[model samples]
Target: MFVGHYAAAFALKGREKEASLGWLFIATQFVDILFFPFVVWGLETMEFVPGYTETNDFKMEFPFTHSLIGSILWAIAFGGIFFLLFGRKKTSGKSIAFVLGLGVLSHWVADLFVHTPDLPLLHGEPKFGFGLWHNKAATFALEALVLLLGLWYYLKRTVAKNKFGKFVSIGFVLFLLLVNYLNYYVLPANHDIIGLTISALVSYFLFAGLAFWVDTKRT
Candidate 1:
């Protein structure tokens, strides 16, 4: 799903402008963030299988992080944390909790559109996905549409508060697309599970840092 997950954050930010886009960005990717560490620890696993899917080479086994039930749990946890962090005078605790929880849940929903049947309904339940990843053209269209539309809506809804805001925001979008392209098309295949996990974590945090920078420059 990649940057498509950010669409939920962007849309939610339009409604809850007070919430930091950085948090929203983290909210949507929290599961993946966890998944990376779990993979590094050998709690979850993946293996490179060349040409198994259009964009993904790894055969993923990520029950603890990508399972539907696990995602819901993560969403609830994030919502609770958000309520505690942002809940204050003039801030609605319940509203922030609900929206942030939904933001977290949106990651699984977006992944369903592109993942192979590697996502689980429960730790032991049957896994399911639409297998959109096998169709590169469709996958590209869906990702681009979601990412661009979200970015457009976000830009339209908020005015830049500093000169750097617009530049950073635009750069963020370009960076996401470039990373996606490289991961999908250009990067050499890697069987080193630990390295893959580390790279994924680095990429996620890199974008998170950029989101924080962009948010700082926005109203």
Candidate 2:
């Protein structure tokens, strides 16, 4: 889902009026930030279980960060910190922070479509998802479309406020998105723990870099 998740924040770009680019970026990926640490701590888990479906091949055992309630709780916790730190100086700070939390929660919502039945409704009740990725080409197409459309909308609604800024942000997004497809669908296979850790770490790195670059270009 990579860049497609940006829709969570992009939904409010110009609408929010004065939201910071960093928080929006943070919102979409806040779960992953929690996810990686939780993964390392063995509090959550994944397996490259081949043939979990026809094409999709990953199984997740994530409760601390991926559960519906856990995600909302994490969103509030992160956004609250954002509010306290930034809202004291400006009212829009809290608004932006609040919206960004919803952005964080949006990840799980979006995942529900493409993921396997690994995503739980609550902490334990029967896990569920539509398994959209089983149709590889369609899954990729939808993911790419969301990223491009959201990013295009983001660029159109806001000026770069600096020379070549929009181009730079677009450039980074393009590169990172390509990298994900390459690493995920094209790269050499590594069906092991090292492989899993590397993938998660790279995902974080790619998104964090894109966020940092976009933050700098914000109007």
What tens-digit string does per-residue lDDT give for candidate 1 at 23-86?
A: 8888889998998788778898877788998777868898888999989999999898778776
Please give the CA lDDT of all the candidate structures. Answer: 0.83, 0.73
* Alpha-carbon lDDT of model 1: 0.83
TM-scores for all predictions: 0.91, 0.87
Model 1 is weakest, by summed lDDT over 10 consecutive residues, at 84-93
For residues 1-219, what per-residue lDDT tens digits would candidate 2 score against the true structure? Answer: 666677656655655757765567667877876776677678888677777754446677898888888888888987788788777688578787778788888889888888877777567778878888787676777777877777777777777868878588688668767875785579765567655666766766567666766756766
TM-score of 1: 0.91
Model 2, residue 164: distance off in Å is 0.9
Which candidate leads the pack in lDDT? 1
Model 1 misplacement above 4 A: 86-90
The runs of at least 3 residues in candidate 2 whose Cα sits more than 4 Å from the true structure, single-residue gaps closed, are 54-56
Candidate 2: global Cα-lDDT? 0.73
